[model samples]
Target: MTENPYLSVFTLTKYIKRKFEADPYLRNVFVKGELSNVKIHPSGHIYFTLKDDKSRIQSAMFRSAANSLKFKPEEGMNVLITGDVNVFESSGQYQLYVQSMQPDGVGALYLAFEQLKKALAKEGLFDERWKQRLPSLPRRIGVITAQSGAAIRDICSTIQRRYPLAEICLFPAIVQGPQAAPSIVKAISSAESYGSVDVLIIGRGGGSIEDLWAFNEEIVARAIFSCRIPIISAVGHETDTTIADFVADMRAPTPTAAAELAVPSREELFERILDRKRSIYRSFSHQIKHERKRLTTTQQSYPLQFPERLYRPFTEKMANLDDRLLRNKNDITANRKHNHERLDRMLSYYSPLQRIKEESRNMDLLVERMTRSIQSDMCKNQDNFNSIIRMLRALNPLDVMERGFSIVYKEGNVVNSVNSLKVGSTVQVRLPDGTVEADIKSIKMKDKEEDSNEQ
Candidate 1:
């Protein structure tokens, strides 16, 4: 027994594959490199080459891993892939079997997920047009979550608290692990089958990206979108968002919020109904009371009883009104006549004709006084004018001549001094004449004695 000296290729491959899988170190590893020559297989697998500064390695990620990835890995994208290094015994080559991968030096898959989310948002995929509106009051709320999860319990308790009358139907689904996406899709479809449900609440408790990835799956999101009933997507914590959440009619931050959205408050609805009933009752009562008062008044009304009694008061009032009217007319006439007489008396006091007569009499007396004053003023002014004319006549040189006054002149000039003549000089002499040329006969120093003797 040479222990099957010739081993089949299949048997040898299986042996090598088993050894590689069994090795603990080879099963799990983290490889950091730049991706290259990446190609997607027809079987939903991916084959790529990871290269660094010095070396290149072949790698492959099965459909399972590729399905979970948020971004498509392209050539030249630096990545840190966590997977196993396994040798392909048939090809006599080693390749990295990728489980999960991410861009190198990046924080986590959450950041990449946010980036993709924002990019999709720009395209308006998460627009309000695509979003559905939650039902105001759902009679039956179908919750798709883990059967043992706290999300289901919280949602049920909250819904019951808000509206105890509402029926809650829980469609248990896998909220974690790889089976979560398919489970959620199936649950949504099942809820749709039950036409009694008005709304669907799909969610789970807070978890990591891997645990919450079911809500981010395209299958679950499409299922939510195609649902006829409104869906309230509550995934992870308040900050966690998924494709299903964006596409849903409403998004609740937590499972409790989802319940709150699905139902209305029983207490509030009851209170509103009670208030409306009271209002209707009060309104009816007020209308009845008003009608009764109208009926009672009609029975007591004079027009409703004896028709002639209605006119009796009017007949008496008419007579009294006529008498009062006549009295008012007489009073008005008397007042008008009195006012006319008073007006005439007042007019006589300040009449223009009387004022003119009085003024004329006053003017006659004023004219007599003025005439005397003018005579007195004329006598004074004439005396003054005569005295002024007499004084002027006394100062006139021609008046002096009229009084036989004579003047002496030499050389056409009046001369009152003997010095005016020069000794042995020609001079003109005249007595009150226009002009005179004279010759001085002598010069005299005894002018004072001569002037005194002449005076």
Candidate 2:
């Protein structure tokens, strides 16, 4: 039998892989294409096909290179890929091993920023409602920035100039370069752990977007959002905006501006205090003038000037009532006397004596009956006079006062209810003996339920 002349499939694939590796053009090639058939493996490797209108190439990005990518690689995305063309032994096919990948026509960092901004926005991190409010007067201000940078100096100086009482606590962090994001996040955590800072200022001086990219990082943004203390973001100049700014309680145009926002101006506060004092003085002065005028008017009034005249009318009315009662009593007594005399005259006219002469034995009985009748009429008239006198006494106000009851007067008006008077009210108590001035120390109104139950 003759030996096979053809090479095995494995041997052929190995030779092709060696050829692809040795080629200088394929070793470091840059290709631009649309991504397709993208799949991320559990092992952290990414497999995809890079395609154009007419051609397609299978590609693989190992974990090491894929980890460096700023933005996620998605299917159908147009990308610029840099890697070596290599052959896969198992598949017996050539593929590109991606060293790095980026979205074509845009900077990697900018694309990453946009993609993160969109994602975080969807999660509501950038919503205005999530932002904290800055304290009006911060006793202690925390600053997170590079210790040696102009940002820290500006913040400290501005705060000191505006509000000398505010204490400045610096959380020195790397504000630029690769380690900046984690450094800022660590500083934020440290501030939280300290827990005494009223406001936190996180920022750097003006710089390029690349120089200020740390503040745009998601970790830093999240740290600022989760911080209990209010945060003021002041990264770069007025034009520069970062994700931290959106998530922060407030955004300042500069580091100095952030410090100003953190603490109130001493001069402005003094002015406010002065204004308040002046307003209070004016109010008190006006109130005093009004009270004095009222006092003067009350002192000169007719009631106070001639105090005795106030009760003269009541005294006269009482005298008239007494006179009318006396006249009524005299008239009632005279009417009763006249009626008795008329009854006597009628008895005499009946001439019972003449009838007695006719019957001497009936004379004693008639005389006894007439005496009883005259006694009965006198007794009835006396009883009626006593009843009238008793009724007159019962209707007298003095009689009611004599029974240990008193009339309550407030401001010359009768106090019929506790609701009409309050605590500290002046009142007059008219008793049987005399009128006593009193003040209401306290008043408690009876509840509806209690009144109903009592009734």
Predicted model with the maximum lDDT: 2
Every candidate's lDDT: 0.84, 0.91
lDDT by residue (61-137, candidate 2, tens digit) is 99999888877788788999899998989888899999999898888888888888998899998888887888888
- TM-score, every prediction: 0.49, 0.65
Please write out the lDDT profile of model 1 over residues 1-455, one tens digit for every residue: 45758888878777888888899998889889999999988998999999999999999999988987777777788899999987787696878999998888764466456665666677676788877766777778888998987898899899888898788888999988889889999998899897899888999999888888878766776687788888898998999878778878899999999888889888888898999999999999999999999999999887878988878899999999999999999999999999999999999899999999999999999999999999999999999999999999899766676566656665567767767766876654433334355566667677678879999
Cα lDDT of candidate 2 equals: 0.91
| Cα RMSD to the true fold for all candidates | 16.3, 36.8
Candidate 2 at residue 280, lDDT? 100
